[model samples]
Target chain A: MEQARPQVDLEAALAASERRFRLLADQAPVIIWRAGPDKQCDWFNKPWLDFTGRTLEQELGYGWAEGIHPDDHARCLEIYTTAFAARERFTMDYRLRRHDGVYRWIRDNGAPYYDDDGSFLGYFGSGIDVTDHVETELSLRRALSQADQYDQQQKQAQWRQEMLIHELNHRVKNTLATIQSIAMQSFRAGVDVRSGLAKFEGRLVTLSRAHDVLTQSNWLAAPLDEIVQSGIEPFRTPEDDAFTIEGPPVCLPPKMALSLAMGIHELCTNALRFGALSARGGTVRIDWQVTGDGEGEQLELTWREAGGPPVHSPGQRGFGTRLIESGLAREFGGKVTLDFAPGGLVCRVHAPLPAEEPPLVGGLVVPHH
Target chain B: MGRRVLVVEDESLVALLLEDMLLELGFTVVDVASRLETGMSAAEQAAFDVAVLDVNLGGETRSFPIADLLRRRGIPFVFATGHDPSSLERTYPDAPVVRKPFLRGDLRNALARALAG
Candidate 1:
């Protein structure tokens, strides 16, 4: 009878302990759930019911799966079932609908439940809303990718700038070499030193003027008219019409323009000393035109003088003549003829015109001056 | 006669300067070609003991092709360039280089080094 009394008290105590546990779980902040050994949900805490806004009858069995986001349904079930079969603890994240019809990210921690006798009961789990945490992680990933893209762009720009500087350095060195060559020619042996110095200064000015035209166009291409005007600008006298220039709008590449300017300067200097420009009534006519098209394009320029002293071929080819012959020919990649007719000197130039602008190599961009 | 040499330069004034330098150094100028096409033919047909090549021609053209031709014929050559000297080392590692605006002695030394190697 004493043992029977203790057993009855024990049963009552066990029932009370279970009631306390259910009360605590219902009042807890987190959503708690329990499933039966048959893999069907049997009970949900008050918080869980409130979160889903569903009655216990509607939420029995697999009804809870209806609240899971469609995208996460398969994955969530796979994880849950896999852990259930193994009777092991598991953690997972999935989006679950709230009472307000908003999907909230939930981090659920689940563990297999066991009775004191080592008999398997089912599974119990708790979930917390972690939508803010998930969103912050996603935004952080996007920001990191954007920063990577900006870093790549900055690197490319820096590389381009370095290439431009390298190209600029190369060009400056070449210009220096050109100047050195001019100096050598101006001060060569067997020439009058004083006159040579004067010629050097004149040629320097001529080179500078050509550079001025090129600078305006960023050393890309220059107009034929601009080059001619720049060449003849220094030699213009009170007689503005002493030189009659006529030419169409012809654009020449940097190398061609430079050579043409130098050639024109040489012809003008000769005319100023011995050609038509030497006399009051003398007049020099400069005419140029583009002929043909495409691959056969050519630049035909003629320099003719009238009303000058009777022309005569020089006994020896001077520096000016040699430069006009060899330099112009090479630069033009065509013929340059000086005809010392009885009337005046006629310089004729024929050269092929490139079809398009040559592509700049290495650093293609020209840095602003 | 001094060592016969060919000059492949695009710029006329620069060509003249090179010719003058070769003459002053007591080398006979075999021929001078101002364009890459003419340069190619000269490299193939011209009879010369050595050659001086300008690295960059008029536009995008480079003298590397001519350099290769000279190499095949076992002819020694020197490269003159306005570009950084190290730039040429990548393509022609063993070739001698003379920077632009160079002294007469620089040309002579480069030529000597090319011929010796």
Candidate 2:
């Protein structure tokens, strides 16, 4: 009788404890949930309405899955089913649309409960909002990848600049070597030193000017008139008299422009030093004509120096003379002839210009005209 | 005399200097092809005891494309370059290289080493 009385008292105390726990759960902001062994929500605390903003009927059974984002609902359900079938705790975080239609992440945690016979009875669960934490993690990963890609691109640009520096150094050395040989031979032959130096400086400046024009297009090509003007512009003076340039605006390939510019430079320097362009009223007229089609096309150029002094042939064949005749001729694939008439100095150069590269998109891409 | 030779150099002075050295060595001079696309093809078409080739033509290194073709045809050709030897070593490791601004004897020795090796 004493043992049985103690047992009843213990049972009453346990019931009181259970009531207190349920009451506390009803007061909390987070929802306490219970489901049957069939995986259906059978009990929900008072806070369930506040969390889901649903009537009792809508908050019961599998109705809670309605608030989940459509994209995540199927995947969440699949995982939930797998966990439930394996009789394990199911915990997942996913977006659920609120009553205000704003999607927010939720952390849903639940553990399977069993009967005395070890058979599944139902489940005990709780849910909390975790949207801020999830968004922070994803945004952090994206920032890391962006920074990594930026570093890689910076490294590539640095390598490209180093290579360019090396190429520029090599090109400058070769230019100096050619110029040195010319100066040495001129000094050895006892040409007028001052005039020779002036000739050298003038030639270099012409070459430099042509290079500057091509550099604007990244060493690609410069227009025919651009090459001619740069070669003769320095001698053009203000006093209402300057060089005349008239040519078809054709872009010359790098090799042809380089050689032709140097050749033109030699002729202009000679004129500035002694020929038709030396005196006060000197002027040069330039023009070019292109004929044929495709790879067969050829360009004929005429440079006439007038209005200064009469033309006369140089006494000896100098480097400038050779360069004008041979260098331009070889590069141009045509002939160059000088007409040293008593009236003026005239030069005609002919060469086959390279074909232009095709456009990226096919067809005769006529611009909006 | 066992054989004759041909020299193909673009620089006129260098060509004259090479011709004088070849004559002193008792080898008959044949021909000189200065420009590319013509130089190596001239070699393949003609027969010479040994040929001296300049690797750069008008600032082009496509000289190797023709040289490689000549080597494949079983001609013993040597390279005489104003450029660096280490730069040419990658493509022409087995081919003999003589740097420019060389002495008269340097050409004869290089020609002999090329023929012998």
Candidate 3:
């Protein structure tokens, strides 16, 4: 009768221990599960059932596999099975689908469990939601890659700017040499030193004006009318009819624009000094037209002066005359004619125009009247 | 009669200025070429004691090809440029270089040294 009493006490003790385990498992924050020796889940804690929004019946005995993402199911099962057979501890990360249709990343750790007698008692595992950590890591990687691309782009921009500065230095030196040459030539001609200085300054200003126009156009090309207007602006009088310029919309390349500006400036300076512009009623008419087709196309420009005193060719050719005639002609790869008529002076230039580039949106085109 | 010289400068005003300087120095300019191609042809056809080549023509073409041609013909030449002399010397170590906007004396000395060498 006493042995029977001890047996009942022992049974009661076992039931109490079981209840304690259940209570602890339910209160734990982690999701816990147990799989049988056959490697099929047989039990899950209250947290696991609540996390999956599944009833205990739906979660027990491999039923939980239904909540695993399809892409991760095969791999997860393989790892679990391999670890189970070896009775070894294992860790894995996989996506688990919740009842709300949202997939969350889960880090699962599993280890073999054994009884006091050293007999295997299936596997005990714990899982924690690691979705936030994984997502943060991925976003960090993306941000790092974007930063690397921006760094590369900045390096390239710096290299390009350095090259541009080098080229600009070279051009500046060359321009200084050109100015020196002009001064030297003017002085060597034995002309009035003061007059020569004035001429030099005038030419320099003309070059600067051309540079401004080219800079505004990104150094590619400049409009013909703009070049003429800038060159003749200083010479324009309030009378408004003393000078007339007519031309089709023409884009001159940088070199052509600069040379043409200098040439026009020389002509204007001459007119203001001794030619048509020197007199009150004199008029200067500048016109140009594009002729021919295909390879034979040419720009024909004429500078005509009238209503001034009788014109006569100078006995001695000055820098201005040479620039307007030979210098401009050579630059354009064309011919220039300068005629001193009894009524006025006439200058004509014929040259090939560069092939037109496709016009961009809001391109620089002066509308013809 | 002075020794004939060829001037290869792309800038017209600079070329004219150089021509005047050469004439004042008792050297006759045989021809002035403002481009590499023309300079090359002139170097081949013209008869001159020496040549003055601009190191760079219009920031695109170099006068090295003309210099090479002049070298082949056993003609002495000097580089006239706005670039640093050391840079030119690195390329043409044996040739003389005269910087732009040089004084008449400097040019005369350079030409003399080129002729003597």
Best by lDDT: 1
Models sorted by DockQ, best on top = 1, 3, 2
Candidate 3 regions off by >4 Å?
A1-50, A54-94, A99-102, A107-128, A272-274, A278-280, A294-297, A325-327, A356-369, B1-6, B35-51, B55-77, B83-87, B110-117
Model 1 scores what on Cα lDDT? 0.85
lDDT-based ranking: 1, 3, 2
Tens digit of per-residue lDDT, candidate 3, span B3-110: 999999877767767888899999998988877888999999999999999887764568999999999999999998766789778878878888766678889988
A325-347 per-residue lDDT for model 2 (tens digits) = 54456434578888887778888
Error of 1 at A168 (Å): 2.4
* Pairs with backbone N, CA or C atoms under 3 Å apart (clashes), candidate 2: none
Query: After TM-score superposition, what is the CA distance of residue A261 in candidate 2 from its true location, in Å?
Result: 2.2
Error of 3 at A15 (Å): 15
Which whole-number lDDT from 0 to 100 does residue A199 have in model 2?
A: 66
TM-score of the first chain alone, every candidate: 0.75, 0.74, 0.71
* CAPRI quality level assigned to candidate 1 from its DockQ score: medium
Candidate topping DockQ: 1
Candidate 2, RMSD to the unseen true structure: 7.6
- For model 3, what is the alpha-carbon lDDT of residue B71? 90
